[model samples]
Target: MPVRQLADAVERVAPRDRRVWEGRLPVAGAGGIAVKVSPVRARQLWMVVGMWDRAVRSERLRGRRIRSAAALFGRSVLEVFWDLAQAGELRALEPGPGRERALPTATLRIVRDCLGIMAGLVKPADGAVRLPSVEQPEPKATVRAEVLGEVYRGLVDLAGAGPLERDGTALSYEDRTRLLAMVCVVLDAAPRSGELAALRLGDLTAGERAVGLRRRQQKAPPNRAEEIAALAEVRPSSVRAVLWGRRHQVSEAVYQRIAAARAELEPLPEVEWYALRPGTQVALRRWLAVRERLVEPIQGGRSALWVTLVPTKAGPPGVTLRPQGLTQAFARGMTALNWVMAGQYGWEPMPTRMEQLRRAITVSPVPAEVVGK
Candidate 1:
């Protein structure tokens, strides 16, 4: 059963899911918007189970919708599923409890998520698109000022966040250190789980380098890492920024950059056409879903720094978390602050945990020789 689940996870996320459903959104002409459209697997199963938007195309995936999922890159539906379920695409013939049951809810959810993930996997200047009606429009650059502002505000707020305030500030020194250790662990866990970015609260100690920062997210497999790390050979400017960052200082800078980028974004046709909202907004709490308030120290008296990584949705289990040591004292120093908590944590899926760590721990490589230079 364990191996079965692992195999399912792999098959579900295999290249078949990444490839466009050529059977559905077949190529038309050059200069198309989305060179290809996403296909549904058990995807329609989601809509079959629960609520969904009225705008989706249910006709596209129907009887004989899928073939197989083998050699999927160039292979067709004939490979994967013996009878590819049209669960990703379905239309209700009747209200409820009818002989005509649509796709399952889980399938529909999978389709949507897969589409989103593969959307970015497209090749640049992939091709042009032709719609049912209306002439093709010119490709234009989007200026997303609002998007930028939203990202900026969210990061700054997170950075400026206060302690859990469980009992009171006078958190015994032992408690502070324990919290710091948890923070490091949490940061390492975020991105792999599938959220966004994450960081540790810090100031590089004198001549300390090689510290790493990483975060994890939820949508990914536990073993796949989605974290970011500080470049080993970073410029002096970046090192200074880390060394001097205050509570949420790095967040503010990150926000400033995102805000600048958002200003240049605009809702693309299909990208926003069937979207839930013209422009999606990410909640900060969604970013820090894993959290716990422990008045007592989990570790008796070990010398390891931890950051609080709170996974979204199910959060991390208290008993299963473990922290790794970094040779750089600066990262260790930042771990002592307890102000920063990376968005990573969860021992059930160990890979997701490391994915988060990879993001929260940044590896700043100062040539070891550059130090004297």
Candidate 2:
């Protein structure tokens, strides 16, 4: 159903932003530019609004955020409500897999951003509900670099052992090689899950010494109106208000300031070429060989660097593995790694999340020699 239709009867009759239905809601972004959200973000926005609408109709939403959403949008209490209690619980309310697990902080942040956008679409009301802040969990403590080094050593040994023993936890020979390469890449380059998933066979250099990574821009730019409002403290309030109302009227100085700040804050480039460690290059080469064999059966060929090990509902063994699949496989690989180091002394269980591993690597970088070993 169209998001506009999800609104109350009075709201439905009001002049609607057609892009709301198209799922390409234009948000004022940095420098007063009308920033269009990526499709993924648009879908997420639709999902949150849908969820909020359902919660309102069921009277399950009661809290300051919903009240604020209503007041901010100049809508009635019945017309706009979000289940802040449910969201605050840090679990998915929907009855499905992963409903019990606490939602990722990133997911919660996105939900908050989406709700704010929805509120911005409407005229301001008399009252206000400050958009609630997401509850942040304590940062996961990173393990020592020596710990990751030892784990990497174990993984390398496992890969060099030729074929893994057949068991429920055992991965296929092809998958084993692929997992090793993935681990090596993560430890060496620390690509995000999305960036890793988006990798293609062509991303590899001629000699496979490095991988060219293209960052997917799934996130929309920061709200332009909000930034302008903030700048009102430094700039003329009247001019800031004018810029807020007319995004295109934003000054180049404002654009340069925002751009500079963002560049400093987000140091990661949109595209980066990371040189692979010797061990990483070797593992990648091995995976490439195994991957070639796997895709040989397919008529046209596959471009994805990572392919499924076995037939799935999506396709045969050679089909591109989705990001979720890659993550699950990485977890299984971690289990296999634990199995390899079952009785080893001076070793701890490796962190399962890629983020944790990245942090550990950043804190104490394992020497290239340790990685190659």
Candidate 2: clashing pairs of residues: 28-224, 68-129
TM-score of every prediction relative to native: 0.23, 0.69
Model 1 C-alpha lDDT per residue in residues 1-373, reported as the tens digit of each score: 2223323433433324445323333321111122332234334323322222221112322333322221121123212221223332224444365443444544433543443222223312332211011233443333232332332233334334544343232333333334333333323222222112122212112222212233211111221111111222333333233322211224545534433332344322210001111111122122222222321244421221233333323233222223232222223333322233344331121122323234433322233233332
Model 2 TM-score, 2 decimals: 0.69
Q: Can you write out model 2's per-residue Cα lDDT over 265-343, one digit (the tens) per residue?
A: 5343455677777888889999989888888998533999988888888878888888888998888877777777878
Question: Residue 54 deviation, candidate 1, in Å?
Answer: 14
lDDT of each: 0.28, 0.62
Instruction: Give the range of the ten consecutive residues with the poorest summed lDDT in model 1.
Output: 271-280
Model 1 root mean square deviation, Cα atoms: 19.3
Q: Per-residue lDDT for 34 in model 2? A: 68
